[model samples]
Target: MTTTAPASGAHAAGSAAPGDEPLLEISDLDITFTTSTGHVNAVRGANLTVYPGQTVAIVGESGSGKSTTAMSIARLLPPNGKVTGGTIRFGGKDITKVRNREILALRGSEIGLVPQDPMSNLNPLWKVGFQIREALAANGVAQGAQAKRRTVALLEEAGLPDAERRAGQYPHEYSGGMRQRALIAMGLAARPRLLIADEPTSALDVTVQQQILDHLDTLTGELGTAVLLITHDLGLAAERAQHLVVMYKGQVVESGPALELLQKPQHPYTRRLIAAAPSLASRRLVSVKERAEVVEQARTTAHAEAPATTGSIPRSASDTIVSVEGLTKVFPIRGSVPWKSTPFTAVDDVSFDLRRGTTTAIVGESGSGKSTVAQMVLKLLEPTSGRVLFEGRDITEIKGRDLLALRRRVQPIFQNPYGTLDPTFSIYRTIEEPLRLHGIGNAKSREAKVRDLLEKVSLPASMLQRYPNELSGGQRQRIAIARALALDPEVVVCDEAVSALDVLVQAQVLQLLNDLQAQLGLSYIFITHDLAVVRQIADHTLVMERGRVVEQGDTETVFHSPQQEYTKRLLGAIPGGSIPLAGSETIEVEVDTELGVDAEAEEIAERDGARSPLGEEPTDPFTGAGHV
Candidate 1:
């Protein structure tokens, strides 16, 4: 094991030599978690380095030890987890040998960490500004009114809108992207030498993700902070990082320049990852004919066997399964007068149709009323006005057995697999619960049905005895899909279903959905914030903003020739759209001197017309509504 110290003095930006000592180094690293059953080796012989002002990305699937390795640097590992053998050096000091107090002091002052899942990381009760102030206070950066002012400045630097007003808001009040930005502000409050961002943008929208990354790149460059980004998005890694580290099964499989590794991957796992990434599946939306050709080509190239055929279930473009018309949902907000309340329209005059055996995607940022429409269609929530017709029948007024029948026909696959699946239920029980509820079969027959569903979702029958906790995020989601299909539903509502998954798992899940639709002639109302996924699976698209349908058309027309400005902005927000894998265009990080605080405030006021670096609005007013 070996470690190297960072350069003692300042150096020109992006001028680090291959022979120059790294700011942080890790060698022959190994980590293990002590569990009740036994000790699990989490990391093995992992090696990495981060030079001054360099952005290095570690890319891998879940449980590949990327987060484990990065968390070990800050000693943020859980009590049961420990580094068995490794050398972690930061600025000439060996972190593994540092005392508790020394490591505590080194955390925010030397190496700042932006943890994954802002909803879990941020203190829900405290104000966002207070949290930022706490970070500043810990590092002795500012105090009193100065600290408050600095917090707002940091928020603005993070590209957050209404920095002053947002600073006074609670964590629950902010959107996922806003909460993430708050965390980033806290992480960079003291301007640490190295920033360890663990899946920082996983929960964010594409445009917000790009903006946050851009701000980090610019600010970190000015401060000369080295960055170690841990993520599963291979396209993001390729686009942002100078160097790439590929991890598989706790081992460093490959490491090299980002573009070189992406273009010509040396490891089989890396190649498989690239193939499974949905963002890299197609650069842009294609015509239906083109999509079919591409799918056929992929099938022929990847598999020696002939492609599987769809079932003989008949479906046509005009056969509408779920029809929504002039749907509106309003909630009453308590006003200053006890007896009176203000009406808040969550969904207003929204209309869309889900055709038989085809996927119709509702695309928008958070709070754009996508999920509200889905809930209305599913009869989970009644609209304040308008109607939902299921199979040419009004389901809005249906109740009792009728609603139960509707449940059997329309099922949902929610966003978080961890939250959706019951932890106490085994896989067999989880899948069979739906069958039991619908009285489809006897106990013995239900078990058989569960086993069949397991096979359908591509899970082994042996997993029937395993509990939800025993499964990975991908596996749990597969179980959820199996459970949803237990009663042979005709329509499925997938609400941000694959947003949290890694690219590889997301691709597999999307394929599974496509296959199921083909096999059973099922229709889908896919609600999501990801435009990239919409381009892949949707047959038709509906663009929503502030509870209204901005645009609706065939997938090809909507994506290729968008008639709405919001739709165009969504398309433009896709990361790596302009940047290519083979290109030599580096990430430019020049600070914008023209962007002042008052100017940013003014931009916030006129956000609807103003544009981000990607030529989109900075904030969506409805971005916080009805999200998972």
Candidate 2:
């Protein structure tokens, strides 16, 4: 899209319309990091601009220079990095050459920055009230009680609950989603002319992500400030950003209006990304191939069958992987006053059952204690009261090896792969560690099995040697899945597993999980606030709020007819609320091979590299037999 516009609603390339000469101007930017290994070009010859009141998106995978370019513009690059070439003029002043002292003054005032992880920006020792006011005071906006009042107002404006009381708490007291909101409040505390967000919602729950995006749209809509949204989520960028720039490695591959580019992508990478985005539709669970023709088109066609819904769930015998009865975690509100006895129950009496072969997703908003439940389930927290049943056994009383066994069975996949996946380990070692520890296999077998596991997650075995930093976001997640699946555990606790992934990558991972569950009879405790995901994979549903199960039922029942007001609000929060489920998309496919019926299973085993039981290796995974 052209940066220049006409007079009535017009803007210029490096400048805006008369009386609106663009909020930021950037050109021929080049960022370099002087590493011990030598110079690394983190960003190369980038060009971008944010107008007076427009949002522009820079989309790319990790290490593609999107974040590097944005950080350089804000002069917030890592110490080793520098703006080697380029001129960044914000409101007509050259930011690249500006003095370090003056740069701080310009920051949070002329331009504000919201880093990827809000938690990193906040200090636990300091009250959020002080942090919020710090930005305001730095810009000479206000000080003392006046700044405090303004901070509270901004928090309220950002849609945070109990604004005044929450302002008194530290960052650790807030949930992942709420912390992000507070960070937004701090960023907008100074009412800067331009705000640059680098994956602002990267680690937040889906519902919270939507809320934050909505708040941003509203806040910016009223303030009429320019926003530069840097993200890897094409779907998200499409919704929030007016224009889009697709970066690859250190160069821009495509640039156009967001919708226009998304609807019809020019780059192959972009096309793959869009085509891969997760759908609201149910995923097919079966993986046995039948014929070559069907196998060729199966990627878009396979539909896994629903689980056996035969007998009533036994009160005792029927397998129950996990159960929480009236579980609550509370923190005493400590103050200088000795007599104060106020308490905040972050997770209040939350209870649910996790079946052995089904998926149950917990959906909710920020501060809803969705994650607290996960932490509690992980035994990372001592529940203030109530019992956590595991395999019909109470786990709270059990510790040491018992707890270790529970952890091995119910593994977690965090939102941020950059943080969650160990950077020091190779994909092979990461996946193999569990297998080796759980005594699944010996060294040679483990290495071979690691390759097989990687293939199951749709990754190449070659990547086994590469470290976490070398892989893509989707790849690292696949490795995470491989590591989780290594032990062949009865249950996998995917706490926001695909939350941070881009749409396409998320769809692929979801499909992989579906495939894995069906093949291995694996159960999932899929904790998330994304209703769309709940509808797609959850056989059962649990709607959580303030640490309580407001509603729990079958997936279809929860999605189609919610009995609780909270459930209805959650369902409504979904972006395209309640789209019909009985439609299909069409795409042409071509196949070269025609395998005989008998050879199909063997073909699939060999191709996919899936292991057949403990010691046996299967045939190709793409055998024609699995398709039909």
Candidate 3:
């Protein structure tokens, strides 16, 4: 791995060969932020080079300075931050010292950006087409009818179907993936020479993510646009970028061809990332019969030793903890005429059984009915038809004390920990409130329970006094988990729980969930669009699309042999499935250890005066143990 050295001299005219002339270059870049506490070095001596018509990715964990480095290229750093050193050259000219007017002119026309969080980036009040047209007019590309015509074309080019109709819809009306496509349309509206994408597909479902990347790649390839992609997903980076730049703390740790660097990572941090990635983990699910056979053979060979166990043995029908029969949900799509509406089926005949102390994952793209099914199971939504049997009791008709009792038994851990946690409340109150609501124990007992819950989640009891905003994303999520367990629920419904976290943090949370499940004998309804995560955490998998379950089986069967094209597409869209990982050998990753076994996480936790559930000399993150 080698750093991209600074190039010298005047800008060359016409087209240049690959690596001959840089399109976007940052050399010895130092970015600083002035805070009331003191000065923070956001970026330190960072060096990155993006060549013409090439896709280069900067990979790192959250707060690793990759986004800051990319934002500096467009002079989009926040008011408190400034580039204190080094040069940012675009097409062989230093742009760091360029005036605001020049920057305004250079932006959109010469350099465009597709930022993360499409919902926040787009204006809710404006129509999608209007936003694209606004970009066109601002960049002096076109105006009025010409811009309007171009806007529709841009949307269509970005892969949105029925672009003309979609143009009239606001950001909120569009699905998450659609809003992202519109942003891509706006970014490329001016046909810039370079485009900076900051975690562009981080929030999207796997299939949608693949589509967005494919569209970006196609458009950029045809337009000869250079891309500077900033992302935390190493698998995504490896699959999409020709060259990969690994950033850590505030500097580049490794840089080279994506495949070479991924296959043979030199840096310990890079190796740790590869080891922690669920995308690189085994996708195969060993059949129950085969596993049983192996377990029996091992036990016989032991000759009076303890019985050998197979991972996640299929539970008998009598052990079914929760069963959904003919579950269906419908919503009415109302227009201006209040009395008239169209019936929209959100979930249709979804049925599955969650075995005791096992994980069942529901996976699909956005608006694919996965979340709806989860909501129904959580008793948060009333299904139009069918029943949810919890321990052989129908929960749909329960009310008052019975409903409250049901709620106490089945709790939820949502995706956004910050959103779910009350900012004004301390972690103690947040966790204890559930106990108070359910009248679980006395004041002293509730306090003790909260502390015990925190320890169970691998968080310190010291966190009890802190507010939501004071904790990191991962910490806050852990707090959420602790709160969910305060009532000692038998069933935990995790709605896209780890999807919003960094890969390393995601691994930790998944591991924590598995550990908690093992200790508490809890059953989980894990809802997510991330197949990689399902592969790691789920014993049984259900594939949903267009309000119906297209496939359902053990995780291994679904991944190894899918009967539905939709299921196959979802698996195929998973990033880095084609890229040979650092270790080709498959290791059975035990359910309890999962992502929590990351050595890097343990090291960071120890260094930070915290602790990771890094029990038993960290096992190979690639291995799995049977669910006990």
Candidate 4:
């Protein structure tokens, strides 16, 4: 394999000067897809360049042509997609007009790709080691025992623990972060000159994401490979890339140094993106005065509305709506022996309380058992041991008509809007199904209710006729929220609800939730891995690790002066946490010192320095397993 010289520039580390000839450059690039309607232009005269050993990022929302542009460089666009205009030069060669044979040869050996979703990208039928070996053999890197040896080395370099054992496992057996690392290992199997990582760590925890990026940085540096990172996260882009390319509606709105663009974004769309990111928002909770005002608003609104003749009304803040005590869920793992299985504890004695009209967020990395606890509280799964009290009644024993009532009172907005909403149902029908099932009103009244719900979510009534496939990710999520509210649920369980949305859309959806809470006196059980999100909306927080609540307290107290080492590490891993922004001098103040923990508690927490349940290894803070 060959490599290009390092980028030259006056800017900070990793950036290239514009005067230098770029290793890969796209000029006046245009891409279009043949849709059922007509030819849809996905990329419009987009221009970008990547210098040797430089890290450049393309930041934009969905449908902004970021992925389309990256795919065009590798000739990996979908069947319906085609490059109509422009020149794509790679290493002084025009790849656009290259023959099919040449294009195939140039892909893995010269330019590698790490797709968005590891689960979908990886072949489920094959072991991870076999896949890496195949990539090596295809690229003429190695074969036989030599290839197997190289595969283990790649896995180890990608930061997977026990690489020899993990390589023999299927994709489903590994955690999400581990799967992503496997994908990265495969992408780097051939040691290509350029690596295109598309939304590489969007679904990963902050700590895991940081670790993956750090590994990528280290390996790419050793190999002198240029990196073109495509993502929707501005913070990640700012933290990792030297140059930032801002895209909007298939056009390049702005391109410059990462810090410059972040500190003082010149484009209107770029400004909007930064403003909408919760991770970039103020870290501290609302002041006491502000919270009081919000509570007053909710009280006035609730009083003005007619009292519910049926169903439950909103309780006061002091009232505990849901109490989880000694919650434990143990799943039996079957071994090779017939009818022999060992118990694997998923949730181990976790406990928390959800106060009325308040938000209690459960946060941790994937496989931390946060979802299991949530399922128990929502009565979707029965706890192996412990009790869940909803309105002073044990939900486990509730059945028949009473259980149905619980379902109406506690609705759920799942993580994947695409999967949760039925494709066959129209937006109006989707929202009306819950109302009809509950026998809330007549046909005309149900139709009116759907419209009201849409309006509440800041969606237009015209969208009522559209199907799930016809809407954007943000729009589909809103429809899901509308459906959840159609039954007038008091406690809405949001399970990774905003994880898939773009920064701007995520901010809108979060604000919508807050507004609805204040207006309807609704409480929430928000489960997510993004601590930045937890800080923005949660009043109280429960930090989970290995099926147990390692730390629990008010959001401000936990964030400002965390007692646990795991909590401190989690807080420190936030992207751009230490990077100085243009307008903002400091990251959002997570707690007011005056109201925060006293000196005594801080000393005790430091002295204790409790070890994490997962482990105390210096690997990814999200996953305790260290790099081999």
Candidate 5:
């Protein structure tokens, strides 16, 4: 095997010729873990190649070994895990058996990693800049004042605003997206030949996700870096990667050009992933013109009946389930000196009406007050001004039994199920806890209720004895849903409910929610940063910026004819939104609404100068599919 000199800094653009050696090559790789139960084969016979300046994505569901394979490349696997067989070649040298000193030398300078879950990966005790500077120092890249300056530069390049101030803050001070960007900055600080990004943008909002990915593209292009992307979001894989590898059941099932595989996937798992991706759900949504016409006709009809009501007005009180009236929340930012604190407004005059049996999505990036609004609605937080009315009753000051009654009628399903769920509680106990708290049924009856709820979520009765740790991410979320439904709530506040699940699992959970809503007449206040998900689940959309609602309307109308630049940018930033999926181009949206409203829509489009919601031609970039 041939060897190259250690890289002192970022490689020049196009440093390696077209026929040069592949930067990373894995052949017949096998990985195993020794658990208390027994030996588990995490990966088997996996093979992939990454040439310099190329991007390859590994796509799979949880337990599909995508992350495990990436972890092995950096030799960062858990202590219980081992590379039992096969070869991993880097720079033409077999690294599967490399020494510790040699591996340490290769880590940051040769192989960098941007791990998933920024909070856990980063040290909470250290300042963000100190952690990054440590990477530079450990890699012998820079130290002292030079390393500090480099750290701030890396943070800026990773899309973090106010990099200098942010560097001094701890991980807890930064939001999830900011922390992830910091991790990205640290990973690229040494300019490694390969960057193993494991779901780097999963927790980020759409616009920031785009910015970070764009930054990665620029840095990698300039440095001739090879990227091995591990993600469950196929739309991201389809749009960003030149090659796609599909892994299932601890093995590589298929690998090929990204677009071709997405358009004509051979494996059943790959096909299912493509079919379930929410990013491609835009094709299923009504066109901007169609939605605009529908709204216009609806308005015309409503106007003929009630002269005062406008299209922008929230639904009438008769059908409205929950009304948020000028909701606002102010948090105090404590200063170093006692009693010196600044008030931070989290939600400013956010008003909306959630109609019965429909979903209202609050969409925005972090710190946009989406969660604050949800909290106020759930009665988890107090609003400094404004009120939340449930079924025409103000819930702000309710206490004791009234609050208990409200809790029974309204429930919340939070983003991270693992964080919310008690690890000590079995599935049965977790679901039963809610029923017990409400004193709804006897122990025997509650057992039956728990079993029925499991069936509602499509989970087996056998899982009742399992702990949360034993369940997959999707399963945990389903359990959360079951618990939320235990009280037979009228309204459910799902905060980033399915954002962490794989595409297929997310599709299933979304379908389950829709099914539940249809059967039980439930209203959902869905708070999320993913516009792709909003298209699939929300009936109405509210776009927030800073702490204010910049736009609000029917989901279709708001998505297609966004009035605000922030909304337009969010829509454009959706991964795979611009990639036309196969068969999506020719799908027609047949509208049976009143005719002659198209002219009004055109007039509005001209008045607003709104860009096409989907941006360019609806052609799948991966498949080279033609425009719609």
Candidate 6:
């Protein structure tokens, strides 16, 4: 990594890069959060810069204060965070002293932000057109038809289809990739000079994530907008960014060129992070005859283990886990005004199978019916029209005792582990409750099992007593996995499960999942928009768009030689091949989320108790397919 040779006595990373002056300069930036326990100095004294038209990435694990640093620049940090000490200068202006209005203008017009999740970023109530107008209006653009016209042009510019039609639809109406495009459109509406993307592609499937990243790269190159990318994915930072910033415990542990920092990272954190991300080489080694076996298995309806175990996921007839046929989901557009609009097809004719013990990833942007498919598979909602087979039996209709039986066979790990579990419940109770319900053991035995599960995840038993809030992002996620594993179902549906985690944590979690799969012979439906992750873990890949499969094949074939332009765009968008960072040899997931055990987790109302008749945890949080 270039940062390995950053300015030492004279060329400290805080210094200017060679001759060019920085466009955005931050010096000795110190930020802290006032927590009840004490003060969490999220961003310690740190220094960094983004030169003209240069992209600088702040890479770190969770609680590294990387996000805190960027958010402070835009004055977007939460109420608890304070810029304790620092000087932020943009275009020679002291932003620290700038008024709210000027800072606001600088935000949308001079700087754009592509937030983490499309679902939360875009307004569910407004149309793409209105949101664009709102953005422009905030940037001093006059409101009216002119703004509407520009909105359509911008949508088309961002590569959305039927811009005119999409303009009138709500956030729920657009596909996942399309929604991200719309959010990008909103950010670029006023032609900002800089773009701040916080985990922009984290929640997407690999294909859609790539497209969005490619679009951003093209847009920035064309408009010369400086980019400040904050992420945990080192591969992404290395692939797309020109410069790098590594943070740890709110400190600038390291900073250098993206390529340099990745290839020859000096900091231990940087090394660990790069080591966590999966690469083609590592994937090839771990998956036996991965490519050959995937094609062979894809053609052969009967599932069985591949001859060579180097390039593919293990297979079994019973492992021919989930199969979907002619799935259709439509939503009625309810308008208060009479004859205002019509219903639309959200997902149509989606069919695919998740073979046993293998990872069949569903790749797409947001709202592409990926999540809808997952929901239907989990029988969270009856498919608008379709059939779902679990272990060769229709699960869509199964209920009562039979349905409970199916639930035990399938388990899910959600995207945001923090939000998946309850803030109130301790990890101990959370993981143990499921064990008790399944009649696996009594209170003592269940507690021991919970602790054992935590140990398997590399967490201490003491963590089981603490609430979700006390743990780090990666740690909380570990708990979530332990809880999911309590049932040890035949199939696991992970919906963007590792997206929110920092790169190292993400890697750890992915590795954990991989280990679990090998040890337990588990089957998984791994849904994500991360190509990097898909390339490493997926046995077979299915690319989705507008609620349909645009491409489906073995992982290597699909990634190395994509058949569809959309697929190509998605692959190209991933921060791969370019970044020369150390890559992971395993798919281990380590993350923390506030979502923990809740009323929903417990079966208090039902006589069956919390124990799923299927002997598994219950959640409709989009694990059958991946969604944001």
Best by lDDT: 4
For residues 258-311, could you state the per-residue lDDT of candidate 2 as single tens digits?
666655565776665554433322222121221122323322221232222112
RMSD to native, candidate 3: 8.4
Runs in model 5 with CA error above 4 Å?
A: 1-18, 156-167, 285-317, 585-628
Writing each residue's lDDT as its tens digit, candidate 4 over 486-571 gives 88877899999999898867877887787888889887999998888888778889999999999999988988889999888788
Question: What are the per-residue Cα lDDT tens digits for candidate 5 across 303-380?
Answer: 334212111223344667688999989999999988899999998999999876778999999889999899989999
What TM-score does candidate 1 get on C-alpha atoms? 0.84
Give the Cα error of residue 384 in candidate 2, in Å: 9.5
**What number of clashing residue pairs does each candidate have, in the order they appear?**
2, 33, 8, 0, 3, 66
Per-residue lDDT for 275-304 in model 3, tens only? 567776543333344333432443233233
TM-score of 6: 0.74
Candidate 5 RMSD to the real structure: 14.0
Please state every model's RMSD to the true fold in angstroms.
13.6, 9.6, 8.4, 13.2, 14.0, 9.1
- lDDT, candidate 2, residue 562? 94
Please list the residue runs of candidate 1 whose C-alpha ends up more than 4 Å from where it truly belongs after superposition.
1-20, 284-318, 335-338, 581-628
Weakest ten-residue segment in model 5 by summed lDDT: 1-10
lDDT of 5 at 260: 69
TM-score-wise, the better of 3 and 6 is 3
Q: Candidate 5, clashing residue pairs?
A: 259-622, 580-619, 580-620
Q: Which stretches in model 6 have alpha-carbon errors above 4 Å?
A: 1-20, 97-114, 122-192, 279-358, 362-402, 438-440, 540-570, 578-628
The local lDDT score (0 to 100) that residue 207 gets in candidate 1 is 69
Between candidates 1 and 5, the lDDT winner: 5
Provide the overall lDDT of each model, using Cα atoms, as 2-decimal numbers. Answer: 0.77, 0.70, 0.79, 0.80, 0.80, 0.72
